[model samples]
Target: MPDIISIGEILIDFVSMESGVTLAQSPGFLKAAGGAPANVAVAVSKLGVKSGFIGTAGNDPFGRFLKDTLNSYGVDTCHMDLTDEARTTLAFVSLTADGDRDFVFYRHPGADMMLRKEKISEDYIKSAHIFHFGSISLIDEPARTATLYAIDIAKKHGLIISYDPNLRLNLWPDEETARKTILSTLNLPDILKVSEVELEFLTGIRDIDSGLKALKDKTSASLILVTRGIEGVDYVYRGERGHVETFKDVKAIDATGAGDAFVAGVLYGIHERINEFKDGHMTSKALQDILRIANACGTITVTKKGAIPALPTIDEVKRFLSERLER
Candidate 1:
């Protein structure tokens, strides 16, 4: 049985080959399996945890590609659903000169959004130590019902719930809808991870301390991780606050799945100490260790290209950290 089960979209990202070009103006593109929850599943698997992905993908080449890619990374896709009603979602990513990205999606009710509540497996949900998800699945029907239903099952089984509201405004009807939907689920996850931009958007606070406080006010999460890109991560656990500085030597070639990689690191850290969780003794020190590795994971990811391909294995992360510390 897998230790972590991630439920959400699993799609392919077509990255523009040229830098500083719009999707329409790009000469060529590269394909990679992406989606925040799926990325985290692979990252956790690579770090030596048994991980599974639960979602729907189109019964097409792109969908097959995603399933194969997840398997290659040691992620179990046994609980996944393949549908012919909709094509697999595709996002065209345009890379900016500063390594940021813009996305143009081609998902007119993509297969991922078609996941029904009936398709989610109760046995599979009960088997995992943690249930991880993102807000993308909550934007539409059927999938939204499925997501909430899974969370309920996970809660019933006492699995640690993890959530990352990897917000993409283009997928929602409006900012208000996005805000309302995402904010409503704040207190649902035992572990919550959000980027700096998401924090400001959700809480209307740009300052780091204020933003964290705002989120804490909204959720009773055991851990709230705030990713700060190059500056590193800010975390709050059991009323203790800490920050971890990111690796400075790594140059970001692309910023696609960096946050997802960080999420994996955090989950892996927690998985390593599942016994502590069972005992209800998740200390601040344990959380800081998790964030430190998570920062390293994000640092390694952006230094490469693509999302899934950019993710580092456990040995790679350890070696990178060792080399950086000795420098």
Candidate 2:
């Protein structure tokens, strides 16, 4: 059984080969496997943790590529479903001069949305110490119900639930629906990871103090993590707040999967110290250690391109930290 299970979209990202090119003007593309939950599953596996992915993909070539990618990275894909009903989802990514991206998705009821509740494996959900998910899966029908069902099983088994909004407004009918859907599930996870913008947008508050206060009140989650690009990451855990500064001079080529890598680092930390976490002995020092590694993971990711392709191995992360410390 894997230590962690991540469920959500597993799709192909067609990245523009030329920098600062729009989708219309871009000359070529490079295909890579991507999806928040799937990226996290592969990230954890790269760090030597047993991980499993549960999602739906088209029974097409792209879907097969994604499945093969996950297996190559040591993620168990036994729970993944292949459907002939729909083609795989695809995202065409064009980048700005600064490596920021624009996305155009081609998923008119993609295979991922076809994940029925009946297809979910209850035993797979229970076997993990942690279950991580993203909000995108909740936007659709059968996948939505199946996601909630998996959460219920994880909760019943006392597994730590992790939720990342990984908000993509375009996936929803409107901003109102996206906000309502994500906010409704805020309290479900024991650990929550959000972007600084997401925190403010969800709470309708600009200041971190006011915004987090509003957010904490809504959730049974004990830990709330907010990531600020380059400005670093901050958190509120059990009423205590802390922040960690990011590494300087990143020179990022692409930042697509940095957040997922960070999430994986955090979960890996929790897996390593499961006893301390279970016993309620998560000291500030322990958290700092985890966040440091998480930050490092994110930093290493952007230096490369794509999501799963850029994730660092545990040894790579250690080497990165050591080099930084020596500097």
TM-scores, all candidates, are 0.97, 0.98
**Local lDDT at 130 for model 2:** 92
Q: Write the per-residue lDDT of candidate 1 for residues 203-296, one digit (tens) a residue.
A: 9999999999989999868788898888888988867788888887766788999999999998899889988865768777777777788888
Which residues of candidate 1, in runs, are more than 4 Å off? 278-280
Per-residue lDDT tens digits for candidate 2, residues 1-327, read 899999999899998888787899999998999988999999999999999999999999999999999999999999999899898999988888777778899988898888889988888888889999999999999899999999999999999999999988888899999999998998799999999889987999988778888888878788889899898988888888888888867788888899999999999998898778767789999988999999999999988878889999999999999998898
User: In model 1, how large is the Cα lDDT of residue 251?
Assistant: 69
Q: Where does candidate 1 have its weakest 10-residue lDDT segment? A: 277-286
Residue 227, model 2: Cα distance from true site in angstroms = 0.2
At residue 86, candidate 1 shows an lDDT of: 97
Best by TM-score: 2
Badly placed stretches (over 4 Å) of model 2 are none
